[model samples]
Every structure is written in C-alpha cells, then in structure tokens.
Target: MPTTEPGRRRRPRASTVIVGALLTVGALVTAFPFLWMLFASVKPRGESVAYPPHLIPSEPTFEFFAQLFNELDFGRYLVNTLAIVAICMLGLLLMAAAGYGFAKFTFPGRDALFFLVLATMMIPGQVTMIPSFLIINGLNLTNTLIGISLPMLVSGFAVFLFRQFMATIPTEVLEAARMDGAGEWRIFFSIVLPMSGPILAVQVVLTFIAGWNSFLWPLIIANDQKLYTLSVGVSLLNQQIATNPSLQMAASTLMVVPILIVFVVFQRYVVQGFTLSGLK
Candidate 1:
C-alpha cells in the first residue's frame, strides 16, 4: 500500500503545471470568438463595431433579437431549420439500422458494399450536386423543405461512424439473446439499442450539428423564403443587412447556441463512445 507521510504536501510536477496552463490558454483562445459573439449580440448597434472593442457590453439589450424575430421574419426561417433538422434525424434512424447490419451481419459482398460506401465519402460533394439536383427536380421537389432534406437522408460517414461504434458490442451477448428466441429486430431494439446509448447520443448530436450547419445544399434545393433554413438565411446577410455587424452577431448567436447546448448535453456520451469504440 502506498501511504503519504503526515503533513506532507504532494505538488504536481512542473511539466504537468505547464501543460495545464497551456491547455487553459488554448481553450480560452478557442472560446473567445463565441464569447464575443454572445456579448456583441446583446450590444447596441454602435457598440458592435466600437474601437478598442469592449469584451462586455455597456448597454445590453434584446432589441436585435426582437428585430430579427419580429420585423425580419426570422422565426419562419428558424422553423424551417427545425423542420429540416427533424427530417434529417428521422433519416439517421434508417442510417443507424444500415450501420447495425454492416457491423453485425455477414452477407455476401458486405465488405465490398461497405468499402464502396467509404469510397464515396472521399468524392467531393460538388461532383454530385448537379446530378442530385436533376434527380430532385425531376421528382418535382424543388423549392420545398423536403427537397432540402432529401439529399441529406443518406450519409456514408454516418453509416461508418455508427458501424464502428456498434462493432464494439460483444457478439456472445447477442448469441445468448438469440438462444432465448429473440428475433433480429427484437435483439436490435431491446438489447443492442439500450446498450448503445453512448454511440446513439454521439450520432444524434453529430447529425443535429451537421444538419443545422449545412448551408450549400439547402440553398441549392430550396428557393422559397418560407423554406430557407437559418444557415441559408444567415448567409444572405451580405445582400440584406450587410453592414450591421450587430444583427450578424445576433443571427450567428441563434445559429450557434443550439449546437452548443446539444453538444453539452451529449458531451459525456460522445467521449465515452469514442473511447470505447477505439478499443475494438
């Protein structure tokens, strides 16, 4: 047994202290932009671009947000964003099921199929945009929220991510469940899914962030102002209110804050998923 002597103080190594200080500085630097966005969002129009920029606002108000939601019809765009995000989440369920099959089932050409999927990830999305648009336009889905979400329904990365995480599960446990007469669906839903909380949370947060931050595809698919997502709308600030840094900060804040909250809620599970999945 290791025992500390009475009245002895154990100090951290100098290297440990130095590393901690460096990491703290790095984190502060990384967070500075977000902090500035939050502070600037609440500041009056004049303070947003004030010289010798103030870290804290002198007079904080919610007028920018009010203008955004009330005068500018930002709420419609926010609703569109939520709708698109929800549709994307529904698609994630299907992708996760595909991942489960890829990870667990042994079928002819399975490896080849998965390899093809992974290879697709390397291809630039720009190459496929025109073809995808033609297909969607052929289906008469242009200028609709569903059109915006249609292309995002399939993601090779999502399949790969969930496959890796699910592969870490013990095969023996699944076999035992089968011996007890559980069907494939039963085992997947009742056993596999319950134990896959960490990975599922990870995927959910990833999908939310990707779907929320997505700009180009949504812009290409939907032309109606009512169907424009927050990301798509925020990007048009150059043409609408290009000079107002305050409104820009306010819009950016709305876009980023939800993602931060989602990440915070799932942070523990996300870390756990990565740590455990790597062990396999």
Candidate 2:
C-alpha cells in the first residue's frame, strides 16, 4: 500500500485549477445568449435594443407574450407542434424496434443492410428535398401536418443510435427469456425495452428537440397558416414585428423553452446512453 508522509496532504495542481476556471468561463459564455434572451423577453419594447445593453430588465412586463399569443395565434402553433412531436415520437419507437432487430437478429446480409442504412446518413438532406416535396405533392399532403412530419419519421442517425445502444444488452438474458417460451414480441417489449430506459430517454429528448425545431421542411410543406408549427409561426411573427425586439425575444423564448426543459430533464440519461453506447 502507498503511504503519505506524516503531516503532508495532497492538493490539486495549479494546472487543474486553471483548467477548472477556464471551463467555468466557457460554460458562462455558452449560457450568456440564453440569459440575454430571457431578460430581453421581459423588457419593455423600447429597452430591448437600447444602447449599452443591460443584462437585467429595468421594466419587465408580459405584454409581449400576450401579443405573441393573442395577435399571432401562437397557441395554435404550439398545438400543431405538440401534435407533430407526438406523431414523430411514435415513428421513433418503430425506428427503435427496427434498430433492435438489426442489433439482435442473425439474418443473411444483415451487415450489408445495416451498412447501407448507415450510408444513407452521409447523403445530404438537401439532395432529396426536391424529390421529397414532389412526392408529398403527388400524395396531395401539401399544407398538412402529416406532410410536414412524413420526412422526419425516420432517419439513419436515430436508427444507428438505437442499434448501438441495444447492442449493449446481455444476450444471455435474452436466451433465458427464450427458454421460458416467451414470444419474440413479448421478450422485446417486456424485457428489452424496459431495460433500455437510458437510450429511450436519449431518443425522446433528441426527437422532441428535432421535431420542435424543424423549420425548413415544415415551411415548405405547410403553406397554410393554420398548419404552421412554432418554428414557422415564429418566423412569420418576427417578420411582422421586425421592429419590436421585445416581441421577437418573447417569441424566441417560447420556442426555446420546451427544448430546454427536455434537456434539463433527460440530460443524465443522454450522458449514460452515450457512455454505454460507446463502450459497446
């Protein structure tokens, strides 16, 4: 056993302290924009862009938020975004099931098929945008929430994430379940999925953020004002209230809140999922 000299104590190195300070500074810098936005969101309209900007609002009010909800129909946009998120989350579960199949099943050409699926990730989304639009047009889904959400139903990244995470499961446990005569679906839904909470939380947070923040595809598909998601609706609100920085900030704050809440809640699971997946 290693022993320290009597009356001697170890202390963190100077380099460690310096690194800690630097990291603290970095975190503060990263968080500044969000702090600024929150403060600005409550400020009176004229004070938002005043010279020598203040970090704290002098006269805070909820008038801008009221305007955002009442004049801009932001409530409707929130409902549309929530509906789309629900649909996309169901699709993500299907994607996870497919990933579980890829991870656990032994099939001919399985490796080749998975490789092909991963290869799709390398293709830029822009390349398929026009073709996807044409297909949606053909289906007469234009201006519909379903059309806006169709392209986001599945993606190579989500499949790959679930596959990697699922690969970490112990095969012996699955074999034991098989010995008990459990059907494949029963084993998967009851045994496998319940044990995959971390990765599932990771997927939920990621898919929610993506679905909430989706702008371009939604804009292209849902030309109808009533069908606009929060992202599109906020952009139009910004355009109409271009001169009102307070209102813009208020709208932006609303847009950011859901994603922030999701991250704060599931960040631990995200870290655990990534760590376990990397080990696999």
State the lDDT of candidate 1 residue by residue for 1-280, as single tens digits: 9888999988899999999999999999999999999999999988888898898999999898998898777899998889888998998778878889999999999999999989989989989999999999999999988888888887898788779888988999999999999999999889888888887888889889878988898878877777788987787776876578888899999999999999999999999987866645
Q: 1-280, model 2: which lDDT tens digit per residue?
A: 9998989998889999999999999999999999999999999977887898898998899998998888889999999999899989888778888889999999999999899989999999989899999999999999988888889899888888889988989999999999999999998899889988888898899889989998888887876788988988878864775578888888899999879899999999999988887754
TM-score, every prediction: 0.92, 0.91
**Candidate topping TM-score:** 1
Residue 161 displacement in candidate 1 (angstroms): 2.1
Query: Residue 178 error for model 2, in Å?
Result: 1.8
Query: What are the Cα lDDT values of the candidates?
Result: 0.88, 0.89
Model 1: runs farther than 4 Å from truth?
A: 1-8
